[model samples]
Target chain A: MRAALYQAAGDVTVGDVPDAALAEPTDAVVRVLRSCICGSDLWSYRGVINRPAGSRLGHEFIGVVEEIGAAVTTLRAGDLVVAPFQWSDNTCPACRDGVQTRCDNGGTFGAPGTDGGQGEAVRVPQADGTLVVVPGGPDGVDEKLYPALLALSDVAGTGLHGAVLAGVAEGATVAVIGDGAVGLCAVLGARQVLGAERVVLMSRHDDRAALGRAFGATDVVAERGEAGIEAVRELTGGRGVRHVVEAVGTPEAWDMALGMARVGGTIGAVGVPHTTPQLGLFPPFRQHLTISLGVAPVRRYLPDLIDRVLAGSLDPGPVFDLELPLEQVADGYAAMSERRSIKTMLAG
Target chain B: MRAALYQAAGDVTVGDVPDAALAEPTDAVVRVLRSCICGSDLWSYRGVINRPAGSRLGHEFIGVVEEIGAAVTTLRAGDLVVAPFQWSDNTCPACRDGVQTRCDNGGTFGAPGTDGGQGEAVRVPQADGTLVVVPGGPDGVDEKLYPALLALSDVAGTGLHGAVLAGVAEGATVAVIGDGAVGLCAVLGARQVLGAERVVLMSRHDDRAALGRAFGATDVVAERGEAGIEAVRELTGGRGVRHVVEAVGTPEAWDMALGMARVGGTIGAVGVPHTTPQLGLFPPFRQHLTISLGVAPVRRYLPDLIDRVLAGSLDPGPVFDLELPLEQVADGYAAMSERRSIKTMLAG
Candidate 1:
């Protein structure tokens, strides 16, 4: 089977690799139908996160089940599904509480030693919780929306979870601090599920700026850092956003998220917070900011999002401006890395 | 009128002073019935909070409304009440949100012009929100609980709020990071309101230990730093306490609060967080902590607490082990300063 294998800088080769088998009784093998690039993928591309040679390189996908292990009872041969970025047993206390990303035995797809979802086929662990049965009973699944549904694997779920963590309540004014695909989706989430009165998107690129606005961003700020904060504050009547979704996983974004919250408001962070908060008061107590960080536990968010998309009220597909064939995987990476597209859809 | 004024280090003295008059329509002249020494009061005694010469010293008190301004409607002459350390308008959105400490207006107490509740004939501002009407119809009040009610002005409310902020669930094990009267009262709050299964009090002084146990602390850890953390983790099945009330206002106490919380638990901080949190990854991403800080908006927690006291369901007075005449406040401060008393109640 051919897969997107990380070889070197500016080097990814789509070629034959050893086919994956059900390595665990709880696993299910899926034939990849659509995969997508995520913001976190750029971490290794920029060498901020080192990738060992020949590492499997994707975590976002929607595909058809090709095989099922003995213990996998829910999913069977030729079943279509959308898999979340992280795999969980669906039985841990945290997973049961809808925070599967913090599952006691949580595991992520892609990266070294993990099966990458962006390939001819991939293996899923704990198939019951990792894969959600697609609407239309699999056969009615729309290919155009496949990129958007596959996005639920990580970016979209993370964006929506960011909204949830930020406490984006009905009529809340939300500012998403990052204009990546996830950030734009956070705007959609702030508006769609949380019923935010206003969604503000902080952006540096025109490509994301358009999608951010389309995804319910009532305001867009092109500036970064303090200027961006000021823009959000101005948009929010100088009190700052009532809720802020921190989608960018950087110190500056973290600080901006803190600044863009109203006093006593919350900053629901789903940016894969790598930087640990300090031991003392990280920000002065006045930000009255409550930061709910870590991965969004996309499994907790997938079910509701699928319902929204199937209902035809939301169209997250607007984020995928540059779709490409799975064979053109390198172009998709370069496009996202260069900010030419908010995301790229990989169709097999 | 005379008042105990904080002059300089070792310079606090009871002296004659100009009469305090109504400064605002919302203000009232309170003939203080009782006052007390607080752990925060020691900051000035230790030359920490450089208070200006002759500034009214005390912040904790229960008092009688001797004179109410025309605009003060809820409180009247002869009405006995507990004055919270901070003044809030009660009508602001922030106050309505149950965080009166961060009230849109009517801010901090005991700063320069801010009237201290400690002295005789002190001015009380924002009476509607700052004062909790003492029950018993303000007639034949239970003088025995006056000290405990006075402590509620700051200490007890602070501890309760700390526990509440730390997100202590009913029936969970609770660990308090300080052993002052506030920390002890937090044990009461946790046990009575939150139904804590275990109340662990961290105390270094024997005088505080006995009082802590009397106030429902099921266990006491005499150690202070890293070893103290180990003790708490050990007691909590090596996972850390389910909830931690940080009642000590120092970096050490703050660190202990972070160290003592289980992953995904809360740390309710009402201990005057003058410093930033520094626990890094634990606070931000890994520990999955929810940190709520601020002066306890006792106004929000008061009605229920006042009821508990009146109904004899809770006796917070056990925390005050010594009583001193107003003239001997110096000795009260000295007694607490020397660890000779758990807490000192001063008559007005």
Candidate 2:
């Protein structure tokens, strides 16, 4: 099987690897149809997050089931499905409560000893609980819908999870920190799912800013730090926003998001933090702030987001600004790593 | 007039002081009928929180309005009232959002230049907004209700705020991480206001533990640190509780509370943090925990709490296990500081 493997910092290779196959009774093998580069993937590329040599890469993908374990009941061979970044047993208390990412016996796609998503084929654990069969069958689904359907695996669902965790409600004034794909999608979720009356996006790039506006951002703040907070406050009529989504996993973004939120407001953070940001207890205490921090339980939001995508009202497919063949997997990672693309979709 | 003033570390004096008078047009002077010692008050008494010489003390009181400035409306001179620990102009955006403690122009009771609640007469800013009028007139409100009414100014209201922020809903298993008056009251709030199905109080003291059970704590955990967490986990069938109220501001309590909460659960923090606790971004992010940290906006919950008190359904009076004359305010502080009493009520 051809798969993406990490070699060293700033280096990746698409080469022959052992084929993925059902290992556990709860596992299934998926033939990769589409996979993409995520912001977190850049962590290892930059050596900020160490990746061992020959490690399987990628955590987001949509594909067709090539084989199912005997124990798998819900999914069968040739079923089109979207896989959340993390696998969970649906019967766990946490999974039942819609926090599949924290499933008691769950694990991530690229964790040590597990098959990764960015491959020709990958073995999925707890296949019956982890894979969501797309409404349409594997046959004749619109090719144009790939990017949008693929987004349900992580990006779109993650953004919506931020909105939900922040308790974004009707007529809320929201500020979305970070203008990455997930941040832009959060702006969309704020407007569509949470009914936010206003969404301010923090962005310095012209292309991303334009994309943010198209995704329903009412205002854009290019300034960083205090100036950015002031800009958000200005847009919110001198009071900060009621809800904020922190999508960039940086200390600066976290601080700015906290400052951008109004007194008593909530900051829903979905960024996978690479740095240990210390939240000083005093300021947030005085402001009565709620910092809802964590990884997005994409599976919890997959059902609703899939419906929204299939309904044609949501076109988050634009997040994929670059596309390449599976053999050019290294190029896909480089494009996203160097900021040459918002996201790169890999066709198998 | 006489007032309780901090003379030095571990030293409080009941001495002559200038009478509280309505200076601002929005101010009202109230004759404090009942005042009580709070857990936070011990910080200064134990020299944990610095206090300037002759600084006025206390922030919880129920009183009778003696005089009102021309701009004061809604509150009359003879009205009986409960004053939240902070004063606010209710018209501010934060106050309108039901977070009065963070009102744009609000101030805490004992802040420099503000009249403290421990005095015989206290000048209250934003009288109409900060003071909740007790339903019955000043003439004949029952003496037995004074302690409960006094509880509303801070203790009971603050506990309820914790429960509310934690989003303790029906069928929730809640764990409160303290044995102080506020924590006991939090147990009550979890059962009464939040409708939590099970309430657990972390207490090592038999007396406090008994009071906790009376306040509706279904279970008690005397262990601290890992053992305490294991106890809670055991009670919840190894999943941890859905709602946690942190009434102790120490970092250890914070960590334990975080550990005790299930994934997707909330930890409502109401304690005045004596130490600057470092909440490292990673643990909370991975756990998907929501840390709702802040001082309780007691004013926001005053009306409903007062109503519950007046209706004879809620009695937080039991927390005040000792009573002292106003002249012995110093003694009341000493008793609570020495743990001789759960809380001490100061009577006029």
Candidate 3:
């Protein structure tokens, strides 16, 4: 089967890889229907996050079950499904508490011996607990809904995670610190699900600014650094917002997220931080701030998001600004790495 | 009037100082009836926290209003009151939100030019906002209630703050990560107010362990560091507790607090951290933890704690194991610094 492999920094290609097969009794083989390039994927593609030679490189996919091992019960062959970024046993204590990312025996898709998402066929572990079956089998689903369904696997779920962690509620003034697809989705999550009264998105690009506004951002701050802080303060009438969603993992973004929150407020961060940052005890204490940081429990949120997408209340399809065939995966990476596309969806 | 002053790193002296008088329109002079040495106060006595020459020491007191400035409306002469560690205008936005420590124009008791709590009298700023009036004036209150009232100013309130921030709910398993007066108070707060099903206290001192049990600790973990983590895991069936109260400010205590919390659990810290602690983004993210770090907004929790105290349901008086007159305030410092007493109460 052909799959994308990270050969080295600035080099990736679609090449023949091992065929996907069930390696465990609880596993299932999935023929990938749709896959995408993530902002996080750029970390390794740009040589920021080290990747060994010929490493499989994706953790988001929606697919059809090609085959299942003896122990797989809830799913069958040819079933349409979405797999969360990480495979988790939903019955674990952590999973029961809605933190499946911390499941006792779960791990990310690209770990050694696990299947990466950006491929024609992949193996899924703990299939019954990790895969969410779409209501309509492969036959009845609309082609246009692929992007939205694929988003529930990680992107949209992550944004919703940030919103939930921040405790966003009615009558809240929220700030989203990044303008990426996840950040834009956070604006949607805040306004649509959490009932935030107002949401401000910090965006430098005109394209993303438009997307952010479309995603329900009430305002956008274009400046960065101290100027950006001042801009947010100005918008908030000298005080900062009561809730902030940090969608970018840079230290500067973390600082801005903290700066954007008012006293007794919260900042929920979902970005994969690339830098080591020191949290100042005195400043956060003085502000009475609470910081909820981590990766999204994607599996925990995927079911609800899938329902939301199928219900036609949410349309995150536009986040994929570029689309191409699976063989053009390298071009997709280049487009995203060069910031020419917000995200790229590949038809596998 | 006499006030305790930190003469140097290891020396504190009580000597004649300027008479307590109202210096602002909103100020009030308090005739301090009871003051106590705090765990935080020992930081200076042990030379851990540097003190300038003759810096007024102490920040926990209960007193009677001796005189009032022109604008002091809610309090009057002869009224008994309990002042929080920090004085704040309850009318500020931050104060209105129940975080009075962040009140605009408010500060700690021993700050330069402010009257310290360990004195015969104190000139309080924002008199109406900073002082909580004791019912029936100073006449009906018994001397036995003095130490309990003093605890409201800092220790008990701080513990309550940790519980409140952690959002402790009924049936929750809680771990209080210190054996200090504040940690003991946290155990009480978790049981009495937060409805925690089980409360664990990490204590090394036999005396404090006994006090912890008396204060409602369901279990005691005497181990520290990795062993402490293992002990807590054992108590909770290999999973950590749902909530943690961090009363120790050191990085080790903070780490333990984080380590003790289950996935999606919270750790509320009231310790004043002395060292710069680096929060690893990936670890917290993977654990799905929320860390609420800060000093307690003492004034905000005082009224409820005061009610609890007056009802005879909660007593923090045992924490003050030694009593001394105001003139021998130096002995109070010596006893606490040498670990001869858990805390010292000074009679004014």
Candidate 4:
């Protein structure tokens, strides 16, 4: 099988890897149909975060079960399924509490020994708990919806997690502090699923801003830093938004999220923070702020998000501005790293 | 009239000051019946936080209404009432949202021109919203309950706010990180009001720990630092508590609170942090932690706490281990500053 591997700093390549197979009684072999690059992947590509040379790289995928072990009861061979970014044994205390990302026996797909999603096949552990079968098998669904279904594996579900953590209640006014795929999805989730009355997207790029508008952002602010905060305040009648989704983890983005929240408001941060080391507590403490942040427990949100996508209410596929065959996986990484594409989707 | 004044660092005195009088249409003059020293007061007394010399001291009291301005519709002369530490109009958006501490026109009792609760008489602003009337007048209630009722002004209410923010629920396990009046009250609130299945108190002082146990702490860990965190984890079968109340705000205390929480847990902090400058975000961010903190909106919880006190379901008066007459106000401050008393109550 061929898979994407991290060769070194500023380097990624498609290379032959050992074939994936059912390695345990609870494992299933998945032949990936679609996969994409995440903003977090840029961390390793830019040499900002260290990754072991020749390690497998990606964590999002929608695929068909090629083989199932004896213990896999919920899924069988040839079934279409989506794998959450992290695999969890859903019955653990953490998983039962809706924080599957912290499940006792859970691990992300791209770890050193694990099978990466950006590959020909993946050996999924805890198959019964980790895979959510698409309502219709591969042949029953439209090929055009594959990209959106693949999104359910990570980005869309992550955005919904941010909205849920932010306490985006009915009639809330929210500010999304990033215009990436996840940020646009947050805008959609806050307005469509959470019933937020208004959503403001902070984006300087016209292309991303346009997508955010289509995803339900009622207002857009192109300013950054202090001016961005001021713009968000102005949009909210000077009271600031009651809920803020921090989809960009930069220090400036974090500061903007803090400044744009009203007193007693909440901030939900889903971005994988790479640059920020310490966050001052005094400011948020004095303002009575509630900050809930972490890696999104995407598996917990997969079922509902899949239903929404299959029902045609959500169209997140457009986020994949560039698509390439598995042989050209290196180009997919380059496009996203150079900012030429909002996201890159690879077909296997 | 005599009132407690901050003469300088480590110095507090009772001296003659201007007589209390109604200054605004919403104001009311109250004859102080009971006022107590708070843990936060030590911040200024120790010079950890600067305060202007000769400023009024104290912000928690229960009193008898002496006079009311023309527009004071909800209060009357001779009515017994308890004033929250901060006065708020209650009609503002913040107040309506149950965050009276951030009310548009709210101000603390000890601010320069305002009357301090430690004085013989206090001119309270926003009378209708700042003061919650006791069902019975001063003479109609027992003098023995004065101290308990006074606790509702700040500590007890603040503790309840912590429990609420931590999302304490039926069958939940809670850990309280301080054993001062507020921490003790948090133990009581978590077990009594929030119905937690287990309550753990982290305290080194035997006296405070005993009170904590009486207040419904199922377990007491007298260890400090890493030992304290270890003890708490062991108490919860090594999973840590789902809810933590950070009643002490030093960096060490914050670290203990963070260490004592289970993954995906919440920490509700009510302590007035004086030494901690910044908190490392990576630790909590990776742990999927939610932190909600601020000065308590005591007014929001006053009514319910008062009901609990009046019904004999709560007895926080014991926290006031030292009591003195109005003439001995300086002695009261000295006792609390020297840690000879958990709290001090002053009589008019």
Candidate 5:
């Protein structure tokens, strides 16, 4: 089998790798249908998020189950599914509450030097928990929609869940504080699901902001921190946004998220948190506020999104502006690393 | 009029002061039926919260409307009322939304040389918004319960509102981070209104803990910060509390409040924010959480609490164990400061 492997900062390659099989009794092997480069992937490739040598490089995917362990009951060969970013025993108490990402047995995929997806064929541990059978059938949704469905595996679901967590409501004014695929999806979530009245995308470039508007953003503010705060307040009757979705994982982004919320409004954050060594958050509260943090449980959002797509009410597939053969993995990383594309879809 | 004046951080004394008259068109001059001390008052007494010399010393009180300005319509002369600590017009959007404490025209009593009600008379501004005409025709309920009614002015209502803001609900397990009048009152709020399944009172004092239990705290932990977090987690099956009322204002108290909540829990804080330099509340996202901050809108809560008292179904009067003559204003602070009293009721 061949898979994209990390080499050094700003570099990656498709190389021959060992065969993958069921690593655990609950595990299965999936023949990748579609995979994509994520903003989070840039964190590792840019050396911002440290990665071990020769690690597989993707976590988001939609695939067909090629094989299943004897212990797996719900999944079998020929089944099509979307794998959420986190692997969890969906039966755990946390998962039952729709927070599967924090499940006691929740597992992380695509870590450097570990066996993860992103290959031609990938081993999926806890198959029953990680993979969801895309109800209608494997061919129920077209292949072009697969990458967007692939996005739902992590990015889209994460973004939408972020907005949902932030209490984005119908007719609400929202400010999305990041410009990644997740942020764009949050804009979609805000408008399509939550029915936000207006979504203000905070971005610097024409490209990202364009994607933001296509997703549902009514306005765009190109400011970063303090200025962005002023821009949002100016846009919101001199108060602040009623709901704010923070999709970037940085202290600056966190500040912007908190600052953009009205005195009594909410800030929902979905940026994967980097442990702050100091164990501190500086000046986030201002009299009355509700600050919610953490990664969104993508699994919990899968059903509603799949329904929307199947119903043909919303098409989140436009984020896949570019597509490539899986073998040309190097160009995908370069384009995304240099901010030339919103996201890249890879064909199996 | 004679009242206790806040002259300096540590100097609050009974002295002759100018008469308090109608300060606004919606103002009313109240002949205070009863007045009392609050923990917020102690901040000025300790000089932790700076105030100009000669400010009045009390904010919580029940009174008879002695006079009303032409603009005052909802309240009139001889009408007995339990006025909230902050005078609100109750007509603003914030007030209409039931958060009168944060009303646009709100003004605080006992704020550094201002005419607080720990006196013969005090001016109630925004009378229609701030004063609640105690129900039962004002003549039916016993006047002796005035001290407890006075609590609706701030302490009890603030704590109760904090829990309410934090979404303490029926069958929820609550953790209160302070053991002062407000903290214990928060226990009452949780048990009575929220119907908490279990209440954890963080207290190191036997007397306070006993009072906490009486006030509806189902469990008590004699620990602070991390240890307190451990105790609460242990009590909630090692998951953490579903609701935490942070009645303590310090950063450490805020930390403990965050530490105590389970993922998807809520934290309501109404601890008269002083020395609010920063906040550290990131861990709850892996657990979902809602953190709401603000003092209770007493005017909104007073009518309900008065009903509870009138029905004889609830009694929080035990919290004010000591009753003192208004002349010995210093003793009220001393009793609470020295731990000799859980709450002091100053008779006017």
Candidate 6:
């Protein structure tokens, strides 16, 4: 099988790898149908974060079950399914508590020995606990829905997780601090799904801002840093918003999220903190603020999000501004790394 | 009139000051019946935080309403009331949202021009909003209940706020990281008021630990730092508690609180962070944690706590291990500063 592999700084390639096969009774072989590059992948691509040479990359995918182990009960061969960024044994206390990302036996795909999602196939551990089957199998679903369904594997679910952490509710005023795919999704979820009365998207790019508006952002601010926070506060009558979705993990983005929250407000952060270290406690503490953050438990949200997508109420596929064939996975990475694409999709 | 004054570092004195009188249409004059030394008062006494020489000192008090301004309608002369550490209008958006500490027009009792709670009489601003009256008048309440009533002014309410921030709920497990008056109260509130199933108290002092046990701490770990975190983890089956109450403001205490929380847990901090600078975000972010912190909105919690106290379900008064007449206010400060007393009470 061919899979995306990290070679070194500024280098990624498609190369032949061992075929994914069921290694345990709890495992299932998935023939990936769609996969995509995540913003976090850029960390290793730019050498900002170290990755072992020749390691598999990517953690989002929608696929068909090629083979199921003897113990697999909930899924069968030929079933269409989405794999969350991380695999978890759903019976663990953490998974039962709705935080599958921290499940006792959970591990993310693309780690050293794990099968990467950006590949021809993946051997999924904890099969019954890790995969969510689509209502209709591969043949019943429209091919056009592939991008959105693949999104449920990571980005869309992550965005909704940010809104949930921020405690967005009916009539809430929210400020989304980034304009990436995840940020746009946060804006969409905070307004459309979470019922936020007002959502301000802090985006300097005209293209992303337009999409944000269509996705339910009530206002858009093109400013960054202090000016961006000021713009958000101005929109909320100088009190700032009650909920802030911090989709960018940079220190400046964290600061902006902090400054945009009113006293007694919350900041839900989802961005992987590659450059950021500490979130200064004093500022938020002084204002009685709440900060909820982490990688999204995408699996916990898959069913509902999948239903919403199939019902035609959600359309996050447009976030994938650039798509490439599996053989050109390198080009997809280059497009996202060079800022030429908001997100990249690879047809498997 | 006489009031406690901050003369300099390590110095506090009871001295003659201006008489308390109604200064605004919304103000009321309170004849203080009970006042107590708080852990926060030591910050200025030790010069950890700067305060103006000769400034009023103290923020918690229970008293009789001596006089009321023309616009004061909810309170009357001779009514018994307790004042939260900070004065708030209680009608502002922040106050309405149950975070009175951030009330738009609020100010602490010991601010330069404000009357200190450790005085014979206090000129309280925002009378209707700042004072919660005892059901019975000053004469109707027993003198034996004075200490408990005074606790409601700050310590008990602040402790409850910590549990609330940590999201203490039925059958939840909690860990309290301090054993001061506030920490002990948190133990009580988590188990008695908020219904936590089990509570672990991290305390090095035997006296405070005993009180913590009496306040419903299911277990006590006298260990500090890493050892303490280990002890807590062992008790919770290798997973830390889901809720942690950080009642001490030092960096070390904050770190311990962080270490004692399991993945997806919450840390509710009510300590005045005089020595701590920033809370490292990476650790919590990686664990998908939630941190809620600030100076507690004591006023918002006073009524319920008062009801609990009056019903004999709560008794945090024993946290005051030392008592002195108003003339010996300096002695009370020394006892608390020297660690010879858990807390001190001054009889007015």
Candidate 3 local lDDT, B1-348, one digit each (tens): 899998987789988899988889999999999999998888888888788889898899999999999998898799989999999999989899888888986899988888899999999999899999988778888878989999999998898889877878887889999888899989888888778889999999999999989988999999999899989989999889888998887889978987878888898988877775666666677677898977799998888888888888889888899999988988888888888888899996
Give the DockQ (C-alpha) for candidate 3.
0.68
Estimate, for each residue in A196-245, the C-alpha lDDT of model 5 and write its tens digit. Answer: 99999998889888888888899999988899999999999877886888
* Model 6, runs deviating above 4 Å: none
lDDT of 2 by residue, A68-98 (tens): 9889999989888999999998889888988
RMSD of each: 2.4, 1.6, 1.8, 1.1, 2.2, 1.2
Candidate 3 Cα misplacement greater than 4 A, ranges: none
- lDDT of all predictions, in order shown? 0.79, 0.88, 0.88, 0.90, 0.80, 0.91
Clashes of 3: 1
**Chain B TM-score (model 2 vs. true structure):** 0.98
Candidate 5, residues B1-348, lDDT tens digits: the string is: 899877776667899888988766878888887788787777767767677787667888888888999998888788888888888877776677676766888878876545787998988877887788876545777876776787767777877887897788888878898888889888888898768888889999898899899888889999887988998888888988778888887878877887878767788878755776355335665557776776677888888887786776666776787888889878888887677888888877
Q: Score the docking of each candidate (DockQ).
A: 0.51, 0.83, 0.68, 0.73, 0.44, 0.76
Candidate 1 per-residue C-alpha lDDT over B202-290 given as tens digits, one digit per residue, 9 for 90 to 100: 99888778878877889999987889999999998787876888887678887787787776677777676654545464354666666
Q: Please provide, for model 1 over A1-348, each residue's C-alpha lDDT reduced to its tens digit, 9 standing for 90 to 100.
A: 888888777677787878978998999998888888777777777677778888888888888888998998888787878888878988886777566877777788885677887788888888877888876756787666676677777777778888987778888888888888788889988898779998888887776788787788888899888998888888877878768887876778877877778777777776665554343453536555566666777887777888877777666777787888888899988988887777888888
For candidate 4, lDDT tens digit of each residue in A233-343? 998888888899999888888999999999999999998777754777788888899999889999998888889889998777888889999788888888888888888
Model 2 misses residue B238 by how many Å?
1.2
iRMSD (Å) of candidate 3?
1.6
What's the TM for model 5?
0.95
| Residue pairs clashing, model 5 | A55-A113, B54-B113, B55-B113, B55-B114, B89-B129, B90-B129, B263-B287, B264-B288
- Candidate 4: residue B319 Cα off by (Å): 1.3
Candidate with better TM-score, 3 vs 6: 6
Q: Could you say which candidate leads in DockQ?
A: 2
Candidates sorted by DockQ, best first:
2, 6, 4, 3, 1, 5
> Is model 2 an incorrect, acceptable, medium or high docking prediction?
high
lDDT of 6 by residue, B182-272 (tens): 9999998899899999999998899999999998999999999999999999999998989999999789998898898998999999987
Which is superior by lDDT, 5 or 6?
6
